[model samples]
Target: MFATPAYAQAAGAAAPTGGMSFLIQMVPLIAIFVIFYFLLIRPQQQRMKKHRAMIDAARKGDQVVTGGGLVGKVTKVDDAFVEVEIAANVRVKVVKATLSDITPAGGARPAND
Candidate 1:
């Protein structure tokens, strides 16, 4: 008496098969990846490229800020290292890639003067 009727079993059938279903299921995932690539990955890559160009273009007499927060003038540059003069007769060798930003040719003027 508890068994399902034959007509009820025949009424419930499997869905129609189509090749488009797989592609339809994948659309959301593909969209998410594309969004992430443009919104996050692409911009970060561009910033890194610009930063690398800036680091490569550094030269003598350029004032730069280091990752360690020391602001100094670049006295020497090598393939992988830079000599920065933080103060009179005080110099430190830092990795070229560790330089954070290169200040403009003319530094900020003192407010007092």
Candidate 2:
């Protein structure tokens, strides 16, 4: 019944070429990782680099906007923080990295200026 047992044993033997089958199975997975790195990971890295350069270049008296939507003029720049004057005689300390946008180089416009 079910053919001779010897026939089944012969069919189960390993291939003469060794582990090439296992390597072939991994090719698709490796290709997917490469695609993800180029299409997603690389661009994110470049964007972060540009943002770091911008953050490092920040200086005092730059008109700026914060991530929280507060617009202010930078009064002082510290290694990791900034002093922003949001209103007349009203200054606040915030992290330098929270700055979102730099106003044009001429500084804020006064109501009469």
Worst 10 residues of 2 by lDDT: 104-113
Best by lDDT: 1
lDDT (C-alpha) at residue 43 in model 2: 89
Alpha-carbon TM-score of each model against the true structure: 0.80, 0.73
Q: Write candidate 2's Cα lDDT for 7-96 as tens digits.
A: 444466666565888898889999999999999999899977776777777788788889999999889989999899999999999898
Tens-place lDDT digits, model 1, residues 1-113: 89975654456677766978888888999999999999999999998998898899888988999999999999999999999999999999999999898965567522421
Angstrom error of the Cα, residue 44, model 2: value is: 0.6
Separate clash counts for every candidate: 0, 0
Q: Please tell me which predicted candidate would have the highest TM-score against the true structure.
A: 1
Residue runs of model 1 more than 4 Å from their true location after superposition:
1-11, 107-113
RMSD of each: 6.1, 7.1
Worst 10 residues of 1 by lDDT: 104-113
Model 2 regions more than 4 Å off: 1-17, 107-113
